[model samples]
Target: MTPVSNGRPVTPASPGSLRRMAVTLPLVLALSACGGHVKGVMQPLDLAAEPRGNAVVDMLVATSRQPSDNPATLFSGERSALPSITDVAVSIPSGKVRAAGTVQWPKKLPPNPETDFAVVRVQPLATAQQGRDWVHRHASGGHAMVFIHGFNNTYEDSVFRFAQIVHDSGADVTPILFTWPSRAKVFDYNYDKESTNYSRTALEMTLKALVEDKNIKDITILAHSMGTWLAMESIRQMAIRDGSLPKKIENVILASPDIDVDVFSRQWSELGDRKPNFTIFVSQDDRALALSRYISGDVQRLGQINPAEEPYRTKLENAGITVVDLTKVKSTDRLNHGKFAESPQIVQLIGQRLVTGQTLTDSDIGVGDGITAIVAGTVNTVGKVAATTVATPVDLLSGNIRPLPKKKPADSGATFQSESAPLN
Candidate 1:
């Protein structure tokens, strides 16, 4: 069957993808158009992360001689209480986490103790003022950047991932990671939802501490996967509570968000003219999200939201948000679920755009064969699915684009693939 790029499944392709089809997939993709319910599901039992790997070594090299603090908690892991904040010397001078456990996954990534120092877990306070006090005491300045991971992640995953972010960004920003109860064990989807709902109040409270307080100069949020929903909800409510989305809050980067696109725009409209410089990172080839499509009855997800309609596209741009398509710029991981954080190309773009606070262009960052293809397919897609590359946007940081000159294809991050999709 010749597939049209409308996101709806066309007649199944006959034994040929490109050579025999004589079909221009790009034309179909041209019409693609595309969230607001955000979320996460429990990961499988073996989803435990591997040792932090040589991540610590890289961090050491990337360090610019800085001192940090204990991370602030956005949501409590404990049902009745939040994680306690203490001076654990999150510094990785020793290069170890809890003296190493007996078990380990060869490919699994380890946690970054250094992140614990940067995004210090804020001690939850009985009042928002108390939380603000705690933040003020530990911050290097009047701003903070918080990270929240989607489903299938553990508290350990959140910390290490966040640490790498702090180290590489070269920004002296305070980091706070909010970890909801993830069961960490896959397959517990319902439980994960429960945890998400349960943590909403605490998440709101944390945001309140930042938004309600005038002392905070900057507030940034980086949420991946299911965490995007929570982040948006928090921001949406903040807008409702006040007349705007808070001027102190600068950027809100939603990477591979697991959200419903229609819902996103609706909620986004409620913010009125108060745009918060938002960014949406999407990849048509994300396998884990493909799995998400199946589990979600083929619903269009964050990574799959396509910009087909010019009205919505203009709406998004006018609202101060950029949708970066990243179905290309290969990386080292599978499933492509972690591309926004793991892929060097996308990472560089983010480090440039958000960290450095610079402007960018399409050719500056490359993706999807100079264009994007969004197809609905067997996936209950809200828009079309065109493969995209995250590298299309220029990094506001290094100010370098046009694919760094490299000799080795392996070094070029060409190994990235979708790990979650099944042939069946």
Candidate 2:
């Protein structure tokens, strides 16, 4: 049968493809579970009684999504002519009741503060000046972190996830969330892809404003799934517009990026010689990327590549990029596409090291030793050492690491033909 996307009929699947889909059907269902939860959970609720040790995350939200008529749902999944900025505070339950790397979604409205993550305050920032003022007030040591969420995410989904990340990671930098219009439907993949394209300029403007701000000494960008594509495109656009990116834009982390491998190579080349410290989190077991690959005419997705393999390893190393292979690090996410934020050790590495402009290496000691220690601990618990390799420009120029081996012939049969292959 032919598959339809955005109401248009597409290519029909072969019998082998049908078998593959049947095998990955469970993963698709697991991925869709989040969509089954209560919508409009963004409605702020007053806590009847203050819970001890509750952590509050204050974030500046900039979105290109149209504002919802209902106050509870601030933004709807539709494109807006202009961007909007708002300040929101989400209250996370105490450490005793909640685990790290998890968002306690409310089961119903007027959520329980002792258990569910509830909204504490929401304030609109009328102008860019107000946003600058907010940054001035919140930025710690002049450090700011911008988070761009992935596909099939609502405004509330982005907000809560960022809050959980900030609180769980204990990152001291000011948090900013840049959310685009995502219909939050499992089947609206085309719409979501186009939405990213529509909002790239807005994101570029946001990044430009932050880079120009004197108050923000350093900026770190963390983007997940399809958002990584948006992030790369925005930065690439910035480079094209202005000869180079400002030095203040320090690091960029792409988690489970959904960009085509060939496209990402082009994006990286366009960034010029001077660019942010680039780090990517990859998983060969990423079922989500598998599905994405199938939908994108069998093109390989950057996030699902086997970094240890031939061309990727040499390509990544030559580009001076750090790679963290999380194929072995188990997480609650059945799709295995969110290990960057869902794994406690990995998230801590982001806050303690990466965001601080510190490069992660197995040999590093002193202030950055936490990365090694955490990796060690994770190895003991997960029974697999998360492979982390650094190929920084400095390391390559200094000849600190050994030479890479010769490339082998590409595996012709490794595409998504296996019935055991995961979903995207």
On TM-score, the candidate that comes out on top is 2
Q: Per-residue lDDT tens digits of candidate 2, residues 196-271?
A: 9999999999988898888899999999999999999998788767766778888999999999887786676456
For every model in order, what is the number of clashing pairs?
59, 6
**Cα lDDT listed for each candidate:** 0.50, 0.78
Write the residue-wise lDDT of candidate 1 on 117-220 in tens digits. Answer: 22212222454345556566656565577777787665545555666565455445556667677754456655665666666666766666666666667777
True-structure lDDT of candidate 1: 0.50
For every model shown, what is its TM-score relative to the native structure?
0.59, 0.82
Lowest-lDDT window of 10 residues in candidate 2? 415-424
lDDT of 2 at 49: 55
- Could you tell me the TM-score of candidate 1? 0.59
Q: Please name the candidate that would achieve the greatest lDDT relative to the true structure.
A: 2
